[model samples]
Target: MAGLSQIWAHIYTTTLVFFSILFLELVILVRAAAGSIHGCKNRPITTTQYLKLVEEKNPACRYKTGLRMESLECAVCLSKYEEEDEIRKLKKCNHTFHKDCLDTWLQQDWATCPLCRSMVLPEEVVVNYWRHQNYQEFDGSDEELIFLLSALHGNYIRRFL
Candidate 1:
């Protein structure tokens, strides 16, 4: 009878653990789904904000000893990072690259680390990188001009069709 009680206790403990794990997993899944539906879009930050975020996200870039390491190479320029060079590091993956290089790369629709291809900004930024091109690419055209250009593209498409 004692052996049977011990077996019963073990079974009860196992079942309790299994249910706990299932509950945690369900909570996580629900949270993830909700986040996907309501996550904020990413936006372009000011130069100072960008620099601050880079420093906050990446601890490795905080120190500069005026020496270049053989292992520390900028994937964008295919060159080693000079100690004097400003470096930016991705937050999640912790991959580092030259600040200028990564800045140019992130100007594209997708803001991803060159090496890991992970997003350069955290998901919470909620900025639409794809629609946001390089600021320098804009010509300060009026809103009417933009609308006309879009209308022209549609008309051309119709003519071709």
Candidate 2:
């Protein structure tokens, strides 16, 4: 009976993981289908908001001090991070990279970290955090946020597509 229970438990755990992955994939698919604009359209942030989010979360610096062995290299450029190099450490995945490289990647409209492919700037999450930060300047009535959001959301499509 003990061995039977163990087998059943293993099967249950495996099935649960499989279903979880399937559900997440379905969600992603539906989200993608429901969107008109490409790139980080699901939830986009402006450079200003991104900088604020970075400051509130991981905080970039002119250079990193090599506190860890893994963060010494920029994944995008495949170059070693040196003194006076601008570094931005992602808050969600904790992956560090050259600021310019990451910015270029993001400007190309990617919503994920290059290494982990994790969503870094999902709008809801950041806005919720800003709300918690007492960001009265970030509410729905703000004109700048609206303009920037429109620019990020559809300007490229209008300009290039």
Best by lDDT: 2
In the range 71-154, model 1's lDDT, one tens digit per residue, is 478888888765567777666776777877777776542567777687666654425333232433323355544444345345
**Between which residue pairs do clashes occur in model 1?**
40-126, 41-125, 41-126, 41-127, 42-126, 42-127, 43-127
lDDT of all predictions, in order shown?
0.58, 0.63
Which portions of model 1 show Cα errors greater than 4 Å? 1-70, 123-127, 132-161
Candidate 1, residue 34: the lDDT equals 69
lDDT of 2 by residue, 114-134 (tens): 898887776565554443344
